[model samples]
Target: MPSFSGNEVTNEQIDELRDAFERYDLDSNGTLSAHEVRLALISVGYEITEAELYDLIHSVALYDLIHSVAVRDEDRLDLKKFIRMMAPRMVHVDSDQSLLRTFNMIDRDRDGYVTVQDVRAIMVVLGEVVTDDDIKDICQAVDMDGDGRISLRDFIGFMHSPI
Candidate 1:
C-alpha cells in the first residue's frame, strides 16, 4: 500500500483513479453521460432522481473539462488530470486499509479462505439484497479452481479485476 500526505498525490494514485473512472465509463466516450451514470447507480442499488443524475453528471463533466487536458481530438480525461481533480475531494484517507479490513471481515472463519456464503453474508451486512443465484454467479466468477471456496488470493484477484 502507498501512503500520501494530506495534500500530496502520486502517479500510482492517478492511475488508480483513472482506472476507476474508465471502469464506470463503459462507453469509452471519455465522458460519463447521464444514461451511464444512472445505469451505474441503479446497478449498485442506488436510487437517484433525474435531477440528481444531471447534477452528478454536470459536476463530473465540469471537473473533467476544466482539469483534464485534451490528450487527443476527443479531449478525453486522462489519469493525471482526474487524480488532481479528485484528490482534494477524497473522503477516505485510509481506503486501502479499509478494503483490507473488509476482506478480512468477510473471511469470517479466519481460515484464509472465503466462500459464496461468506460473500453473501458480507453483502447482507452491506445492505445489499443478494440472492442465492447472485451468490452462485459470484462464486463462479471468483472460484477459478472450480473449488467450493475462494482463497484470499483468488478473492483479491477477483476484486482487482474489472467489473
Candidate 2:
C-alpha cells in the first residue's frame, strides 16, 4: 500500500496540478519559482527544510523546465512539466490498484460499506489524526445515496475522482 498522498497520478491529478499551479502562479507567469513552490507547499501544511527545498527545486527540474517550447527565452517551471517531474515523488506506490487495496484493507468490517468509524480506524492505522466530523463529511460527500455510509463501489469511485 502506498502511504503517501498524491501517488498514482492520473489525468485528474494532472488537472489538479494545473489548477494548483494556476492558483499559486499569482503573477500568471506560467511558471513556479522556488519561492513560489515553497509558499504553496507551506499553505498545504508541508514544511521543507532549506536543503530539502533546494533539492526539490532541482529535482523537479524547475530551473531548466520552461513554460512554453515556443517561448524558449522564458525559462521557468511550467505546471505540466512540474507535475510530470514530481509525480514519482508524490506517490509511494506504482499503481492505482495498490491504493485501492489499501482502501479495501481499511474497510475491515467487510460489510461492503464504510462508515465514519471505519475512516477513523483507517486513519489510525495510517498514523493520521482525523476528527469524527471530518470522517462524516467525507462519507457524506461519497455516499450519494444519503445512506449515511459509503458503499465499496462508491468509495472506489470517489477515490478514482480528484482528491
Candidate 3:
C-alpha cells in the first residue's frame, strides 16, 4: 500500500489536489458541499455514501467539531480541509496485492529487483522515448539504498512517496 506520511506532502501533490478541488468546486465558491465532495471522491475512484463520507470525516479527524449534528446539506469542505481529509486516505487506497502486482510487472526478470535495464526495456515496450540518462536518473531517485537497483522494498517506498 502507499505509505505517504503527513510531513511528506509535496508541492506537486498539493497542486494536483488543488486542481481536483477546482474541478469539483462547480459553483466556483472555493468550497465543496457534501454532494460535491462525494462527486470528487467518486471521480478519484472512491465509492462513498453520504453517511459514510460524514463518518469518515469524523473518524479521520478532518475538522474540529464544535458540536455534533446529523448530516446537513450545508455541510461543506474547503480546499484545506479537503486536503487534510484526503492525505491519509490516499495512503491506504492501494492494497499490498496491488503493489505487488505492479512491482512484479516492473521486475521483468523475476529477480526480485528492478534494475535500470528492466525499467528501460519496459519503457521502450510502452513506447516511451527515454534515454539511458533518464533511466539512470529514475533509478537514482528510486534506489534508496544506493545499490544501483530497486528492490521490492525500494519500489514500494517509491510508490508510497509523494510526487
Candidate 4:
C-alpha cells in the first residue's frame, strides 16, 4: 500500500486497513491494545519496543488522523483508527524474491516443496509446539493445488491473500 499525504484515500486502501485491523483484533473486540498492536507489528517483522510503540501511538500525525472519535479511554484504541494509522506503513514483503527466500529457508529437504511436517519439525527446534491439526490446517491454507504441500506459487498466493 502506498502512503498518502493528501486528504483523499482510495477505497482499496481503506479496505486493506480494515482487514488488517480486524486480524489484529484478537478477541474480536472493536478496540486494540498496545500489546495486540505490538504482536501485529512483530508478525510483519518489526522489532518494536513498548516505549517506541507508544511513541507511535502518542506522537505520530498519522495517529491523529486515524484515532477514532469514540476513543474516550486512552488505554485502548479504536480498530478503525488503528487501521488508518497502519495502512500507510503496511508494506507486505511478499515479493517473488522474498517469498522464494522464505520458501527456501523453510524447505529443509530441498525437494522443491514444503510439507507440514517440515514446519512442525522446525517449530519443534524453535521450542514451539505445533499440533498435527494445526499443521494440517496450515498446509491446507497454502496448498492451493491440494497437493498437501506448499509450492512457490501457492506461497505467493498466500502472501497475496487479504489475511
Candidate 5:
C-alpha cells in the first residue's frame, strides 16, 4: 500500500493505475503527457473534462511541492507518480450501485462472476490492444480468493478494500 496526504491506497488500485499508465504511454516511454493521461482515465471510464484534469493535476502538483515529491517532469508523469495521483480519485467510485454496474459490464456472460474470457472479450470489443496475459493479470488482481473468478462479493470487496 502507498500513502499520500494521510490517505492509504491499496495494491489493487495501484496495479490498475499502472496498467492504465502503460496502456496510454503511447510512445512506450514509461511516462504520460497530459493528453495521454486524459486518454488513460477516459479508457478506464473516468469521464474527466479537461478542466477537471487541469484542476486535479494542479492540486497534485501542490501536494508534491509540500511533500518534496516530483510527480511530473515537463508535463509527463511516470508510473509511480501516476499511481499516486489516481489512487484517491479511484476511491470515489466505490458506491454499491456503481460497482454493480461495472461488475455487470465486465461479467459479459452474466454468469454472476467475472472471468478472464469475459474481460478479454470486452477488451477486444473496446479495441484495446491488451495481451492475453494482461487480461489474466487483471482477473487475478480482483479474484480475492485465488479462484480465477470474481463474484459480486469479491468485486465489492475489491472496490471498497481498505487501503
Candidate 6:
C-alpha cells in the first residue's frame, strides 16, 4: 500500500496524489464530498466503501485531520488534506537534523515521546493496518527502553535502524 507521513512524502507521491485528486474531482472543484471520495478511490481501483474509509483511518486522527479543514456543508472535506493525511511515514534521511525533524513529526503533540496512539495514527493514516498486535510489535521494535513509550533516543534509533 502507498503510504506517506508528514513532509517525508516524495515528489512522486505528491504527483500521484494530485493525479488521483484530479481524477476524482469530476466537477473540477477543489473540494470533495463523501460521495466524491468514494468515487475517486473506486476510480483508482480500491474496493472500499464509505464506512470502510472511516474504519481504515483511525477515528480520532481522521476526525481531527478532517475537522481542521471541514467544510460547512455536510460530508464535504478538502480532498488534498485527506490525501496528505493518509500519506505514510517515510524516514530515509540520515542526518541528525533529519532525525529530529522526524521525531517532531511523529511526536505530534511535541511530548518528546512517541505514544502508541501517535504511531497508530500515522500508520493507519497512511493506509497501513494498525491492529492491536501491530502496536505491540512496533513498541517492541522502537521502544528501546521498554518504558512503553518511544523516547527521543529510541525514535532516533528507530529512524536510523534498518527498515
Best by lDDT: 5
Q: After superposition, how far is residue 105 of candidate 3 from its true place, in Å?
A: 0.8
Mind giving the per-residue lDDT tens digits that candidate 5 earns over 35-127?
A: 788867754557566788777667667777887976546367777667767877776554466567767877888989988888788676555
Q: Model 4: which residue pairs collide?
A: none
Model 3 bad stretches (over 4 Å): 1-93
lDDT by residue (tens digit), candidate 6, 1-163: 3444435655654554565566556577786656566554543335465688655444434556566844344355466555654454222422455457656766889989989889887666555565889888977789877888999899666544533
TM-score of 1: 0.50
Candidate 4 to native Cα RMSD, angstroms: 5.3
lDDT, candidate 5, equals: 0.73
Write candidate 3's Cα lDDT for 1-163 as tens digits: 2223454555545554566677779799988877677756653446566689887566434344443533333367778677767776655344434457667876889999999889898666544587889999989998988988899888767655554
Arrange candidates by TM-score, descending: 4, 5, 1, 3, 2, 6
Say which prediction, candidate 1 or candidate 3, comes out ahead on TM-score.
1
Which candidate, 1 or 2, would have the higher TM-score against the true structure? Answer: 1
lDDT of each: 0.58, 0.59, 0.67, 0.64, 0.73, 0.60
- The reply for model 5, stretches above 4 Å from the true place, is 70-74, 92-163
Ranking by lDDT: 5, 3, 4, 6, 2, 1
The C-alpha local distance difference test score for the whole of candidate 1 amounts to 0.58
Stronger candidate by TM-score (1 vs 5): 5
Per-residue lDDT of 1-163 in model 4, one digit per residue for the tens?
A: 3345444455564564565566778788787777767655543445566788887666444455475443365556676556555655644443355457667766899888888877787556444566898888878988888977898888778755777
Judged by TM-score relative to the true structure, which candidate is superior, 4 or 6? 4
Structural similarity to truth (TM-score) of each candidate: 0.50, 0.44, 0.44, 0.54, 0.53, 0.41
Evaluate model 6: give its TM-score: 0.41
Find the candidate with the highest TM-score and give its number: 4
Off by over 4 Å in 4: 1-10, 34-76, 90-130, 159-163
